[model samples]
Structure formats: structure tokens, C-alpha cells
Target: MNQEALTFRAATAADIDAIVALAESAYRGDSGRRGWTTESDLLGGRRTGPDEIEDFLCKPRSMVLLGELGDPPALVACAHIAAHDEVGYLGLFTVDPTLQGAGIGKRVLEEAERIVRDDWRLSTIEMTVINVREELIQYYLRRGFRRTGKFLPFPYGDARFGLPKRDDLSFEVLEKTL
Candidate 1:
């Protein structure tokens, strides 16, 4: 993949469906299996929906950043960043399943950190990963995020998050100072 061809921008309401689709393709169902980020083996149901994306887009100090590529521009990656006091919260990150391991995710993350440090003027950024996702956590660790050892219970009963494949699901907080 041509890393230089990728561009970043704040997603609008019009892009909600595309973002949802991208996330689902990258994290759930058979398509997600193409990438190392797939949570299909651990969970089921939709990864995200329009309501969730719209909520993020409407929130103050929050934005859904998108990464696009190609001539007509395709929505290949996305993440949700929101200001929480002096820190920035990052979530809903995903890249096209077929395009994973091509350095797109790293670029998107770097851009998110830049937005937190320069645009939001926040010194720190944090994210949560499924506690069992050691590989994913290591990926973040290599990118400067540290394990905060703060665990948050996964919303098991809530289908909005996902339908857990097992009962031992939880999230671990990770942080980085920009």
C-alpha cells in the first residue's frame, strides 16, 4: 500500500455508514478474519452502528477521524478521539481488514497522537483494549502506549458492544504521553 496516498480528515454524519461498515469488516464477521485485528473469535454481533458513530460526531471535543486512500478516496481506517479533561480518549480504531499490516494503522495512530498533542493540546492519550488481546496490546506497546493496569468490565449484556463468546471478557486501559 502507498502510505503517502493516505489522507486524514474529521468524519461527518454523512460518513457514519461507511465508518460502521469499515469497523465491522475489520473487527467482526468472516471479513474480519482476514486481518489480525479481528475479534470474531472472541465476540459476535456488530462491532458498531450508526447510532454510536452519530453520538461521537455530535459530542463536543470529540471527532471521528477518517483515513482515506485511492483516487475517489475510500474509507480505509477510522478512530474516535474525545477530550476528557486534560487527556484525550481514543477508541473505535480500525483499518480495512484486507489492508492490515501495511503500516496504515501505525500512520493513523501517529495522526491521532498528533491531533491530541497539537489540535486538542492534550499531553496524554489513552485507549482500552480487550484484556485478553495480548497481541493487540503489544502492538500498542510498541507504539509508545503503556499498560495502565486499570481494568474495566466489558459490557457483556449490552449487545451494543458485542455478544461475548465467553464470560471472561474485560478491558485494560493503556496510555501514552504525547
Candidate 2:
């Protein structure tokens, strides 16, 4: 829970499994129910796979950041950031389900913004959140993101994204000016 106790670093190919596991635990299935971020009721199936994660790791101007704790360190938080022209895209954000709401997520977010702003030298950052997740939207709103009123239709038949449990699913674009 101590924000200072966490260390942040870019993830490598070796971290694909841990990142995928942490993402699954934070957003999918029964294990994700322990956190407020769980999408279990909205979707089913894998949140991410090794192939997708490896692709992110290999992409240029993209990074998978991991937040670790303890002496040798254990992956507890992670996010994917990618630069596209003048904007930075943020996704695959996860914090260990058991460790959610302890300010760790905030710290991880701050670090992500730092990378986007200072490292990438980008002036703006953007993300997509499920439109129905008001609480999650509010969380990002509190951190200075604003709804852009742009909606991306959820891939209904794509198991790669998830198995949508409802027909109303879609993503709303959120942006912040750094």
C-alpha cells in the first residue's frame, strides 16, 4: 500500500506471462471479482494472451510498464502505452486484484503519464473505457481525463477482446492534455 514501495520498469518479453496473469486477475472471471475493476459481469474469456503481449513488447514507440514490490520484486501492476503521431494511447492497465484501491493504481497511472509526457514528449494521452463503466470513467475523470464523446463499437464476435455478455457494450474515448 505504500506508494514508495513500488518500483516501475518497462516490461520485457520475459514478463509476458506475469503481465497476462495480472491483467486476467484484475479484469476477468471470478478472480477479478476481488477488485472494483472486474469486468466479469460484462464479459467472459481471456483478457489478454502471450502473443498479444509479445506483440506489444516488440512494437516500436510502445511500452509495457510493470510495477513491482518486494526485494526481488513481483509484478503487481502494469499498463501498455503506445505513441501514435502526437498522442499516446494507454491500455491493458491492471493492478493486482487483492491490492487495488491502495493508491497503487494512482501511482502506476502517474508513472504512465510521466512516460507519455516526459519520455515520449507527447502533449496528450488517450484511452478507451467501456462506456457502461461509469465508476471507472469517473476514476479517470478525477485524474483529468475528459470524455471525447467518441464511441468505438465493441467487437461483438471477437473472442480476442472478450465474450460480451450484453448487447450494449461499447467503448468511449477519453483524453487528457498533458
Candidate 3:
């Protein structure tokens, strides 16, 4: 696929199912193994389903943005953003397994940040990543997010998140001033 043919915009309610499928294929299940983002070794089951995606779509001041690839009109990537307290939260980030490492993820993130800063008038952006995901954390840190050492316990039984592979699993918050 020619990435030069890509386009991006806020997702519509009709795009929710495809976005959810893309998220699942990029993060979990046999389909995810094709991409480096897969957590197959650490967790299992659906990453985000239709209902959760609908919540992203219906939330006030929040969105699920999709990047459309050419020909097939597929959503190759997505991110969820919302205002939280004093900062905007970035979540549900995913890139099609085949599209990872080609700068698409970074572009999606930049757009997400821009939306928070320009659209929401937010001064900061924040997100939580698994504490053990050192490389992933480094990826964000390099993007200017700072480590606050603050963490929230990973929801053990919440399939909406993921099942813990180890006892120490949890989320460390990362923040950046936009």
C-alpha cells in the first residue's frame, strides 16, 4: 500500500467497528502477531470492542480519529483523546501491524497532541503505559513526555484493559506540556 495515499480525520460512528478491528488486530489475537505491538505473550482476548469504541465516539470533547489508507479505505491507525482535569489524556493508540515503524504512529501521535493543544486548548497531555514496556515508554519520552513516577494499579480482571501476565504489571503515568 502507498502510505502517501493516506488521509486522516475524526472518526464517525460508522467507523467504530473498523477502528475496533484495527485495534484488535494490532494489539492482540493471532492477527496481532504480524505486528510488533502485539501483547500476545503477555495477555489475551479482545483489546477494545464495539461498545468501548462507541463510548469513545460518544464522549463529550473526546474522539477516536482514524487514518485512512488508500484503495481499501481502511483505518490504518487510531487514537483516543479526552480532557481530564488539567490535561488532555491520550489513549487507544494503535497502528496497523504492517504500518508500524514507518512514522505513521508518530504522525498519529503528533496529530493527537495537536488536537489536544489546538482544539481543546490544553496545556498538557498525559497517558499511561505499562510500566514494563520500557521501549514504548522511551518512545514517548523521546517525544517529550516526562516520567512522573506516578502509577495506577492495572485492573486485574478488566478485560477492557488486559489480563496481567505478571504480578508487578501496572501503568506509569507520563505527561508533557503542550
Number of clashing residue pairs, candidate 1? 0
Question: All models: lDDT?
Answer: 0.94, 0.94, 0.87
lDDT by residue for model 3 over 1-178, one digit each (tens)?
6777767899888888888889888888888888777877777777888999888788888898787777658789999999987689998899999889888888889889999999899999999998888888999999999999899998888887776677788899999999
**Candidate 1 or 3, higher TM-score?**
1
Q: Estimate each model's TM-score.
A: 0.98, 0.98, 0.94
For all predictions, the C-alpha RMSD in Å is 0.7, 0.8, 1.3
Ordered from best to worst TM-score, the candidate numbers read: 1, 2, 3
lDDT (Cα, tens digit) per residue for candidate 1, span 60-172? 99999999998889999999999999999999999998999999999999998999999889999999999999999999999999999899999989999999999999999
User: What range of 10 consecutive residues in model 3 has the weakest lDDT sum?
Assistant: 65-74
Residue-pair clashes, model 2: 0
Position 155, candidate 1: lDDT: 92
For 1-178, candidate 2 gives per-residue lDDT tens digits of 4557999999998899999999999999889999999999999998899999999999999999999998779899999999989999999999998999899989999999999999999999999999999999999999999999999999999899999999999999999999
Q: How far is candidate 2 from the true structure (C-alpha RMSD, Å)?
A: 0.8
